[model samples]
Target: MTAKLADKYGPWGVVAGGSDGVGAAFAHRIAAAGINVVLVARRVPVLEACADEIRAEHGVDVRTVALDLSASDAVARLVDATADVEVGLFVYNAGADDISVPFLDKDVDTHLSLVRRNCGAVLEAAYRFGGPMVERERGGVVLVTSGAAWAGGASLAAYGATKAFDLVLAESLWAEWRGHNVDVLSLVLGMTDTPSLRRTLAAKGDAAPDGIATPDDVAETALRHLGDGPTWIHGAGDPTGPSPLGALPRRDAVLAMSRSWAEE
Candidate 1:
């Protein structure tokens, strides 16, 4: 598996938001496949620590780039930092909205920041990294999204919109790049067991529900299915199937989504 992955998408991989949780899991898994990794995140200490652990555990070269993906120049900085490497695999996993509140409750700046990170940065990374992959005719790109993307809901407006953008972007890229042998997956996650999710739940005086997906499982599933392009629903019975809400009317789907948030 290691040699095969290295041959196909190897040399080096880049994991944005790789300091912890799903991003860290991706870095570890990629390293285990005998690929060097560049881990990018805003938290310097955590990022370095994750890098060190990957180096120790997998004996793969690990580079840390402390960067805030929300920044306008984040992808430019990332390209500069990684210009020396042949990045055959790129995973954009940084867009997790911790604030689940009514749209008007949060200021415009907060929403804008989310947009910049989730939509702008994702698009930039995919274009810059995926272009080379297509030219080389081999590589993989994973865009981490969420089930919230299936429909709009109260308190999930901005986040869902951005994730929906990611979903369509990944699918479109897959269609365009499939002939080039470059795989693109929009990883749609439901309730996942991650520090970010834990914190968000705790803020609401709640705990993680049973059967929530694990970061390692999600990462493993994605790596295994890198060739299964377009989209992958992490915990769904039919991973490549249409959304569960697909049959419903748009208004009904939105109402269902709103109720789910209210229950949570």
Candidate 2:
């Protein structure tokens, strides 16, 4: 993809959970387009390292903010940190759950924390950053979702639910902002070789190789299609068409998803 996206939504871009994996790849690609980037992550070292690499490689201005997106004050701190920068693109990519146990295996607070981070903070970012995009009559938002959102699985209760929330939020925003010249894309993903994914697979005792996407591929595909609003399913025959499992019965789809997630 060309760097025209940067010009269309220029000045700056923000990527939450941007220290590594898909988030870091996005930061690199956006910076390569000459757009200054603000990368937010929890670990200060990782965040700084990623920022420095973006500066060294892409040579675009980079800012690092160390904040836990799961925290209540995350979006507030992010807003304060980049208040002066014109953030034309916002990618909410921080929803990564490393444990996929049964619903009740985790406590209430743990589930609530994921919900707040995946849903609440995402909503706040859209409102705070997207508000300006609407005002300027340009900009973009990419909400990283998962195929887990397509169906309910045995070990994907909270995580899948939150992903579904992201998908719907992105699609709804796409609908609302299309006429306003703001692009919104719900980037649905499957298994990807991200650090977070490796940790999750290790936790589940499933280290066998499987068809997984690379973070660089995912980031490149998403950035190229940021204007392809509503959805951009990674590695799908029809990215904007119905779900791959849409033709199957609901029970069948759920059972298939359960088996696939369990085996993977």
- Number of the predicted model whose lDDT against the real structure is largest: 1
Over 4 Å off in model 1, which ranges?
none
Q: Give Cα distance to truth, residue 150, candidate 2, Å.
A: 0.3
Report the Cα lDDT for residue 167, model 1: 95
Which lDDT value does model 1 have at 254?
A: 100
Considering every candidate listed, which one attains the maximal TM-score? 1
Local accuracy of candidate 1 as per-residue lDDT tens digits, 58-157? 9999988898999999999999999999999999999899869999999999999999999999999999999999999999999999999999999999
- Show model 2 residue runs off by greater than 4 Å: 208-211
TM-score of each: 0.99, 0.97
Residue pairs with clashing backbones, model 2: none
Alpha carbon deviation, residue 81, candidate 2 (Å): 0.6
- Clash pairs for candidate 1: none
